[model samples]
Target chain A: MTSPLQQKLKINGSSVVTANRTWDGIVVYRTAAKGWSADLAEAAIVRTPDEAKALLAEAVADDVGAIGPYIAPVQVDDTGKILPGNLREQIRRDGVTIDLPV
Target chain B: MYAYDEIDRTLVNERVSEFRDQVKRRLSGELTEDEFKMLRLQNGVYLQLHAYMFRVAIPYGTLASNQLRQLAHVARKYDRGYGHFTTRQNIQFNWIKLSDLPDALADLAEVGIHAMQTSGNNMRNVTSDQWAGVAPGEIEDPRIWSELIRQHTTLHPEFSFLPRKFKIAITASDHDRAAIKVHDIGLRLIKNEKGETGFEVLVGGGLGRTPFIGKTIKHFVHGRDLLSYIEAILRVYNQYGRRDNIYKARIKILVHELGIEKFSREVEEEWQQIRHSSLQIDDEVIEDIRSRFIYPSYEKLPHMPDELRQAAADPDFEAWRKNSVAAHKNPGYAIVTISLKPIGAPPGDATAEQMDALADLADKYSFGEIRVGHEQNLALPHVAKRDLPALWKALDKLGLATPNVNLITDIIACPGLDYCSLANARSIPIAQELTRRFANHELANLIGRLHINISGCINACGHHHVGHIGILGVEKNGEEVYQITIGGRADESAALGNLIGPGVKFHEVADVIEDIVEAYLALRERPDELFVDTVKRLGVEPFKERVYATR
Candidate 1:
């Protein structure tokens, strides 16, 4: 069985546009409503390469809200939920997995 | 510790205001990401995987109690509830927001601390002997000179934009507590036959993709000529160091390409032209430098009081005192090393409450001063011998008395993929796993003085190249694996570790370490031989053979 991190790394066609929010450096995704959201569920998923490029371009033009916008490979689950495609992105999405001091 | 003067105060305050304006411009879409990155980096801000990591200097690992409380305040106000102490002895806030940075800098500056040149390609915070003024068999305090270098290097106009980041480490003792040999420029204070304090200078040493033990260029530099000589070396590096290749741009590469003898000649030539100029330090300047520093007042008590022996009656206190306490130059005092590595917590992390508690304890017992060791541990360098029992009980309550200094579980690891953006795999989890696997105190005591360091990439931020047992994280195919090295040490005789064999899976790291430990126990010449010594007596092949054959 593959590790959870390895499983996340195996992308199957789905992608999304993501960036860090400009004010606080929080990870945010380009939403289908032409805005940004911290939740991956509200992200605008693009399966085709051209669609990913267009979505990335739209995110880049909205640089006033975020920084370093780029297209990232994502994975679609059986329940139609979007998951981050790699461990780095997954970490950015869910925060640090380990227990940090409060 | 050196207090900030008027000029220093102005510069820091100006930088804070400048950063506020730049941050405003960035939010308003006036400055692009590329344009604002260098500015933020100069102020010790870097974007990590989760958020912006703001690094603040401890200035040669020395901190006052109130200064430490200010760090705790920053931790509570601007960052998460904790801060990570880095291998360089600086503190890093891993979850700071960009919007809160200007206020954070201003607040930190009020306590005479700023993050200037903490992250940029400028001379970084100078690291020195943690037991600088108090250690036995020491010359003059190294902090006086470390502070001098710190003053000279902060926003130095000529040396600001060097080829790459430079690090300097200094020591005043024969024993290498500062690991000076692994630095870009290592300064060792030695007394001549005439009994004058001078420096033995070593140049061009570094770690990362390339690691070199610093080569001594000058046998002795007079106290007054120290700054002149250092400036000459930096001038030569600024003129000749490679700029086209970022990977090969450090002074180590330049020194390697030029050969040490030729590099020495160039530095000498530069020194001759500028030695007597305004950069030269006179006796008055040295006196001024000495006057700027604050020294602890020793009470002049007898060595090893009866209360110390009485306190040692408990076996648990005995264990902690043996591992965590060291002899002080002054009698009736001991340097107490507080272990930041609790069994399951991150290696160098301290929560805000813990920081506040430790700072107050430091004020009450350790003369209101604390020193951060390069090994990611904190030290109360001037604790009275009489206070051992009380200090130990307090520390035990705080969960900082782990009795694992220099033991197997006291691991040195970088933030890696958890916080750093440049890591290939996660290193903290590997360190955590190893720490948990070796949680047995008896087993840890038996397998003593093993330095296990982990880095996620070739950057060697964890100083893995010099660890007795080094682990480097890399991704194979899609999953993470770790490469192990044996026999490396960072000391007066610093040497890089050699790779043992192929990379191992993350779950297999603990087993691999245990096998190596068992093999060393079986193969060592005597029970007292260090693991590095055993690996040296017999090369990596013996340990390699045992590990691979067993697996």
Candidate 2:
């Protein structure tokens, strides 16, 4: 069972922004898609390489009016400098662009 | 006496600009009150009930004459002609306006002072022994490590927002003058088996609603790796510490819940990852910082002057000598404590004129060196014993010659509901009433050595919990109630006080205290029976019965 903080971290968009990083949790991605609020059932948690690819695909699909490709990870090193590891950079390279409804 | 070089100057200048921009943006309503609140707090700006307060850091409680003068100028110009020295070895100007904060920071920067990390969850002002360099028993100056901590923690990106606010205190001497046991991180410099000095570090100690004496986490942390070790501890705290509940957020709670062995092992594990990194003490950097704290060359002098000998023979000087003077490292010199606790005046308060006079006297008698202790008292740490009479005469004219150093009337009280936003009752008026209650010097001397610390709230701003006779002011319904605790101590054997039944009404508090003191007088073990010893022998039962006879 996940706590509200964990559930909140699981959702990339909606009111819950990325809180902090954990060693083995899904890195959240905020969606630009309108009318798409994160329900607990819809939240993603990836553990495998296939699941990671699926998460990136879902995030790109949800970027209808692509506001950002901001990767929100839970943890970082002691320097407070953000780390973009291989997985994160691979996701960033597959960024999508979407036009917003005026 | 640490002097700022180019890096220090540049950092302070950049911070000034950042604060200036923050102020402009705040005033323009570009940021919300909450956002700006955190920002201002990060810079040590507190909005009290009446007005904004600017708490400036007096690092390790040492101040040059020029810094003292600059603080005085700020009091005269920015504040309402006075600043309050706090328990953390910081000075606070209570009446600063929101708009004037930038100007105040600029003025402070001119004297190499700032409010940075004086508040917030980051490392607060690194405090050490106020009598750091001059104390006779000091192995080495703790101010060196204090400065190193100050530099290492300043704007450290990783540790800015931790579980709760972190406080570090250092003591170079065997005596715990810095109150090391009650701080978050307490370091005592000790000579190890290798005949080299290093720090014995204690962690997880603080006093508020929940007080815990710090535990020794590390038996010996060498002079190097101080920064990285601290960083590792902070990172562990930041990552796993409770953020949902503010009360359980302090590292003490973590240490308590996880057990010290586990907590310490975790910290050690984290420290192993970053042990000898760039965060370790760079020799060049240490040398650069250490060079600033080197003592100024003093002229060699004889053991004692004839004038000092004659004054020591005088009766009045004899009394002052017994009370106000401390042993000096330099012969023919003494540390003079100018008691702010006058017969009728508020303790720890010096009017603007009094501050100026003290600054002048510092320049005249004490080799321009001044130190403000955690007890809100000022010390001229290097006064020539021969100039005692001259110094006494000058101080007498300024109304600062109270001759009540550590006496019963030297009450430590907080700025209560009158100024503080978190206060439940007024502390200054109670302190004043008690001062007038015990007006006679003979009576005060008769009571012997008793420390009465009164706090308006449970925040322990006045450090009431550690007083020999602690009074905590709480609000019952709409009226103020005073709770009395006996046998509390803040000395080498510091202990939390035991509560004496329920609290007394505000009007009857003075009378109740008088009754308690009377109880002490009647239960005389002897004339030399200090309050703590009596309380220790008889326990708090006698005082409790006297205080709450009708309850």
Candidate 3:
């Protein structure tokens, strides 16, 4: 939570709070249930400044397992699902952009 | 092929235990993330894009079979079942859990391998020529000096931290296989007119946001004076290298800022004081390190047995031999390059199964030794010519025999935006697509020796600046695009490539490369003129025109 991304984000649309789980370094998002979820679709999307601040605060307050929390923009498709708004976050939501042998 | 002594084992094991305690504290919140970051990086654990990345040093690109098997075990047990061989002659395992790092370090220590200083702003893993002792016409084996440097620089209290990371590479041959011209410090073994061996020392070469070819600081330093001379350079750099701007912290910037003359004057002043100090290498110690080298027992035999030549009549076997195999210093022996660049797979990646199988093959065919070169490929440094057909077939089954050494598809690339946190765009997909586009397809074989390197960002970990054709990922607007360069070469005559034409979108990169190849083919006066040589001869004017003509 003390990472450089702790600074404010200039959001144009809806956003979500995201971080990597400390022990495993897995990407996770702040969920509507006030907990972390590994899936970005389950992330709590916020549109307003106040909503974004409250949701990111929830992430920053949790230091036990979450680290380097930051706000990233997201978009909602017609199906009412959260989609990462940028290539970087989308790849973080998915795995690597290309096929790599496991 | 250096075996770990008791001291080396104890040092690694003790550090492993100490790091386990540090990780426990970090996880329990007794230590802060900022403090723990330095500790973890010193141990070669990096928090990357999706998961933690653990980098392990493969000393001078040499590995014993059992050591490789241990790596396979770690890859299978702690990671995503594969290890990425980097251009630095190191192996990295992505997707390792932060908590699993301590256990992984312990496991690797059993094989006399540790990831120490593979990251951090300290002296990194010292790399050398892959075919050091086996290659014909090398002035002398450079691994001896590499090992000496490894011991001197590892945990040297004076240089525990520096303005930025430092890298050193030593190559013994005239061909400069180590890419020494672009390293922080390059040491080339040479003989003076007095018939005594010495080193031609070059300093301040590096590749990053700023690229520089190293300039020779000293023409010849006596073999015994190498460590002192190098240490003096480090001392000067540690004092005068920039610390304000992260972009300018490398020694190359300092040398550039002060000009090479002033930098040389500073280094000379410091070296004269330390020339006769305890850092001077003694013959006994060099001999001790040299004696530890696991030299293979060879049978005096004929060169390229008639059988291998006959087998070369088969196109598949012949192509692999001519391209993927190199002449060895020993008669009837071959240095087989087991390329990790498959047609569509990630360059420099080996699955656990492949690692285990390659270990077996190395033990059976190449004196239980394997080497990883800076080109992101693995080499079996000593293989009998007779066993090559079987080796190629086995490698083919493992999906490693791509037969494209020094070919266009034998690319050197970094784990770009896909894994690195600093990348502006993804590099692997571009590399994968280019490989699928060019490897052994169309006139790729006819294109002859060409090198293509890609980097995700300006950090240039992929050595993109020296590629015959370099593709660098950049962001234009909101989408990913690539900036291509032509005519770079990483060799004895190292030169940075010039940017050609405008940057193109990711989807068009493969075609753009095809056009560049086509332009080279058309522009060259003879088929024998290499793509790099053609560019060198004609400059980038014609290729620039050809690539951007339709745009």
Candidate 4:
């Protein structure tokens, strides 16, 4: 019976803070329910999103097999809103968002 | 022109063979890719996205017609029928194969040219004023010192791998068209207190992540001690400059961390150690390099001509004279800049035929010599004033006759995400769009002396940070977007531009730029005020309001 905010807090993944900052994986923030919001960091302020996803595709491929495709299915909420974890997909889905360390 | 003696010829021939063998070893797999990359880069070879690029040095932007003919031959034989003249006064062929590089080197060597140090983190081809010999306002021809530095720094054993890539620009004129401020070292040849000619050396200036106007380290370093002083500076940098982080490796950052006074003291301490050594430029060596740069004997022509007076009466010729031609040292001669930025085209691209036409123009008018400016434009530095009409006719046919040298339309754009692998978005299209949006030559001339630079990424190959109106392209939501910064300059007074507000979408960029221009027009004190001076007088608030009105 954990809330979405609590779930995000529990994930312990890297957070995108700004476009200038570096991120290990693709950082996505859901703006509203079913609306993905990317984290944007100004000079000092950090705005968190409804949902965040870091695609584990590169890490998975390195760990497992290159021939076999790996997918990191990320859910914003429990209502079947899933996002791809690959860097290219994140770039396609969300234009330019801040990436801050969690 | 300095004819190559046996020593010069032998050195070039031997270096060509050495590079030829290096290429052979690379192809045979005896040298690893990493090992061969440095070797090839040292020989001016780069593996660009599509093919191997060979960059040939046009020393201080000076070249002979025979040398250019040789380049044209290489373009026809080995490359894609054209060569890209870069910002460093070097020509790059982007389609050369790895196998044919040696042959290309051999061809270049035949004309006393080599691809040496055109790439790599070495002392690159020394760039000076493209109008060095013919400039009327200059203190002296800087090519003499440029050639001296080229010999002194080329493969100097003690200072090869210092900090990062080092660039040096020398200028004798009051105006710094060579962009002396953006280099690691900027040497200005000036008259000293004792009425002696020497260099007022500036160090720690560059434009990348952290842009800086170089500080004057020495008030006056004697001309004879140029080599010794430069060696001292490099040796000091080599010892203590950061090597761990690539971003912080430039001598500017080193000079930033250690204050200018401290840095200069260290350099002076090092100079004292090496003052009287072999590196100290002797009187004989200076004279030898000086003799090489003396201009050819003139025909003792008249200062003014009636043909020029007639051409001045013609309106089209008058506009071309005002825009294209400059006063030269010789009375009957003029330095004509062939504008490569035709409307809706890349800034510095001359077609294969245009190259031939330029070569022909050089041979016919400019004493069989051609010069390439740092802004990617070609110059007929010694064109006779009487021949301006004929030169205009030839250039007009080739589409090389845009009369906007320092106007708003003459944008300095890099081969952005289109061709370069490191580009985040396309830069050429933005330039083309802007050119089309502001197609009025009169309007462009009205907004005089504004530099617009675009770089796709932050590596800053295009020098976007220093542009008067700088645009940096980044990707946003699978689409191209450009961020605008205003009020940057790269002349003697170099300043990094201030960011206006947010990134504009690719489609809105042209409109935003139009609005910015309109704002400048409304608030300007006079019509003659430049964009930089006006921006300085009135702050960026008006520009920001105009740019972000609809946001």
Those runs of model 1 whose alpha carbons end farther than 4 Å from true positions after fitting are A1-12
Q: Record all residue pairs in model 3 with backbone atoms less than 3 Å apart, i.e. clashing.
A: A1-A68
- Per-residue lDDT of B229-328 in model 1, one digit per residue for the tens? 9999999999999888889999999999999999999999999999999988878877787898887788977677887889878999999998999999
Off by over 4 Å in 4: A1-102, B476-478
What's the CA error at residue A11 for candidate 1, in Å? Answer: 9.6
Off by over 4 Å in 3: A1-8, A32-34, A48-58
* Local accuracy of candidate 2 as per-residue lDDT tens digits, B257-318: 88889989999999999997877776787777779874755556666778877778777667
Q: lDDT ranking from best to worst?
A: 3, 1, 2, 4
Best by DockQ: 3
Q: Ranking by DockQ, best first?
A: 3, 1, 4, 2
lDDT of 4 by residue, B1-551 (tens): 55666877898899888878876775565664545667877888764433466788988998888888888888878876877777789888756777787888888888899876687777778899898878887898888899888877777666556667889999998888788888899999998878777999999988877888899999899987888899888988898888888899999999999999999999999999988887776778767777766476676666677888777778877766787889988887889998877788876666556777788888898888888888888888888887888888888888888888887788888767555546677677788888887778778878877888888777777788889899998877767789898898988888888889889887888889899899988988999888888888887899999888777
Clashes of 4: 13
Relative to the real complex, the DockQ score for model 1 comes to 0.55
Better of 1 and 3 by DockQ: 3
DockQ of each: 0.55, 0.01, 0.74, 0.03
Q: Least lDDT summed over 10 consecutive residues: which range in candidate 2 chain B? A: B26-35
